[model samples]
Target: MFKGKFRIVAVICFVLFGVMAYLSSQMSFGPRDKILPGIYVLNVKLSRMDRDQAIQAMKKMEASFKQARTIQYRELSWSLPMDQVGLRLNYEEEVERAMSFGRTGSLWQQFLERREAHRSVHLKPEIHLDANLLEKTVTAAAETIILPPRDAGLIINDNDTVEISPGREGRLVDINHLQQELIKSLLTDSRSPIPLKLVVAPPVRSTEEVSAMGINRLLAMYSTQFDPNKVNRAYNVSVAAAALDGLTVAPREVMSFNEVVGPRSTEAGYKTAPIIVNNELVDGLGGGVCQVSTTLYNAVLLANLEVVERTNHSMPITYVPIGRDATVVFDAIDFKFRNNTDYWLYIQSHVKGGTLVIKIFGNEQFKKDVVIRSWIEETYNPDTLVENDYSIRMGDRLIKQKGAQGYRVSAERVVMEKGQVVKVEKLPTSVYKARNQIISQGMAPPGDILSNPELPADDSPVNGEMEEAEER
Candidate 1:
């Protein structure tokens, strides 16, 4: 009776094992239209979902996860725009990958993988970012945090001299490492701001290295005054001068002012100021730039350099005498000069205390005397300007401008060494056009007629220009 009972129990156990094996084999070998019972893509559970369903699920959350990325550098942070990064999610690929899981290999192996998925095996989703955009975004932000090493520079003295500025080391961001941190954070779905990694950047050129560049002494220098109260014009003067400071021109190389100075646009750090257009003071971009060119032109002449090309303004300017000024209009009209010296020509410019100064330095002794001589062959006075307005008081006179007189002037540069005339070079003939002496006569009644009061003189260069005037 006992033997019979044991056989019944053994038979029942065998039947149960057979049923389990058949079910596991069918699960491993069957056609898979849906993901396995426990599959995940980048922590998104895709259990028992079809490829389309899994794709839709990922697409729903992609927008929320792919943006709001920020990079932090201590006190500063930059939130990268989604458009700039061009972040994209490849949901279809991830869905297909999830669908294929546990679908290949031997039956036993497939069964084991399907089982492992249930306990939580994480797979990363395919994420794409525009490489160029990512690099630009990271680089732009990194620049703010990075303190780049600086080369030795110059300090112009009040007496037309120079002092060497020392170079120094600085801290710079490790762009590659920072880029990696950003990528890793995004990939790992970590939304916290990433930190910056920095490295040491040593200065390349030292004060001693700058001294060896053949800049031994000041060859010549020139200065022009301006009205600092004209805020925009004053700001523009400083901008243009900054571009010219600590510049070097090779021996015999002709340097174009426009090319060296670059474009005179708002993008190039210039502000609107008073400029000469059609013999009238008008508002235009890069107004005070001509003052910079004119100042440098005088310095070049005093240095005994060669003038390649130059043009004068339509009307005589107040900063420099007639035939002494130089006007530039970017790509159209330019003021250029050749470094006629045997050594490198180093230039230093500064705008301070309502005065703009330009100095030229080289490895040569400056001439004992350099004079800009000018003679006016013909001259004519401006016509009287009359303005009648009802708004002003009667018998009251207001002089808008003192007015400018026209002239035909010829100029030359005379260089002397040890009391002996060494060289003389003729400059372009300047022709200035006449303007009107503007007077406003009021129509409103007044008790008495008053003398026309002239406008107060200011350092603002009303005659400075940014565009070419009629070939004057």
Candidate 2:
């Protein structure tokens, strides 16, 4: 009985020691005897661990604690915020590395709290100058500057009355400079509005006004005395006057005589008659009008104007010489001349001394001695008389016989220059009719002692001797 009890006690003790060893392994802490005194508590908790799973539970808790302790808190700057973007990746990597080491639970919690606090920190931005604003200021400073506008006008002096001149006080503006200033101002960003400048320039004058002065001087030098009231009866001065209204002769320009005078006719209030072709009397328009054109032609030549076109009359005109006369027929006939001088010309026409005269006023060079002359080339006979023959008796006897005839004619002209022969021109040709010639005779009685008183005395010679011979 003593041996049995001793063996039983040994077996019970063995069982109890095994159970205690297993329980110690399952717990979060190692054995009390093996652990150091005042050791830091990890505070790891495992709610669903089996009693036999204490060793495996302790190993898992140790891994988690180490991973948490390895995690670090990071602070970032707003200017260089790249850390924020990389923060999550860095945190995950640190956790994985720490987990490789052994630290558990409460340590992991403390590391997470530090990381959150760092993330919550706000970063401030640094102060710096704006490059765009600086560049704009630099450009504005380099722009061109301009002056303001001012008023100005012309001034005259009593001593300079004879010579009209421009005043020094007149405001003058440089157009090119003004344009540049305008462009610069428009491009500039100014706080105040800049008003446009007003520029004053010298008074503008036309070319015509200058030319008028020259024309006036020329007219004063060459103007001649002429009587408008003495104009010839043949020309209708009133019509010519009307056509000349508002007519101006430019320098070195030609004027057409026919074109200006137009057609002369009763409709135009012309009462004068003109000789026409065939010597036959005919009432027509512009009959005596050639006198006007002829007069103007002479005046133009005297003025030394260049003749562009000139046509002679088909027949002689009593009013003017052959070559000197100009005939116009509406759109068909025309006489034109050019002003050959540098000055302008003024034309004036009037009737004087039973003649129509045209005067041209210009420079003195044209007013020199000038003359025209003309004459007839041939004379034509007038119409001849016709005689008629008729028979009649004192008492039924033939008495006498009669007969008749007719004739016609023309003339030409010779133009002279300075008493020298210049040209021989034929004027309008004239045609005349022939006159009739007539004769009459009577019969004599048979010879029977009949004495014919109509016989000449020469035929009655020695009548006494012939009578004596016949008696024998």
lDDT of model number 1: 0.77
Instruction: Give per-model TM-scores.
Output: 0.58, 0.34
| Candidate with best TM-score | 1
Q: Give the TM-score of candidate 1.
A: 0.58
Top lDDT prediction, candidate number? 1
Across 1-472, the per-residue lDDT of candidate 2 in tens digits comes to: 9999999999988877754453334232233322211121133322222333433444443333222111111221112111211111222232232222212345444334323322331111111223344223322322222223222221222331111222322333343443334233322412232232334553353334433424332221111122234233234544664465335577767787666765555676765433333322234554445555656666665544566776655433434433455556567768787877776565555544444445455554444443434443444333323222122221222212111112122333343446776555443332222212222233323332234457332221132211111000
What's the alpha carbon RMSD for model 2? Answer: 41.4
Clashing pairs in 1: 227-459, 394-444
lDDT of 2 at 413: 39
lDDT for position 366 in model 1: 43
For 1-472, candidate 1 gives per-residue lDDT tens digits of 9999999999988876764575356453344688876678767788778778888888865776666677788888888775577677788778887887776777556556777775766778766667677767766766776677898876656675667788988887665676567667866878888887778888888877777666767888899888788888888889989999978998789999998888888899888877777777677888888989999999988888889998888877767777898988888889999987667778888888899989888876543478999889799888987878555678767775667778999999888888889888788899888877877678766754344444332222344432222221
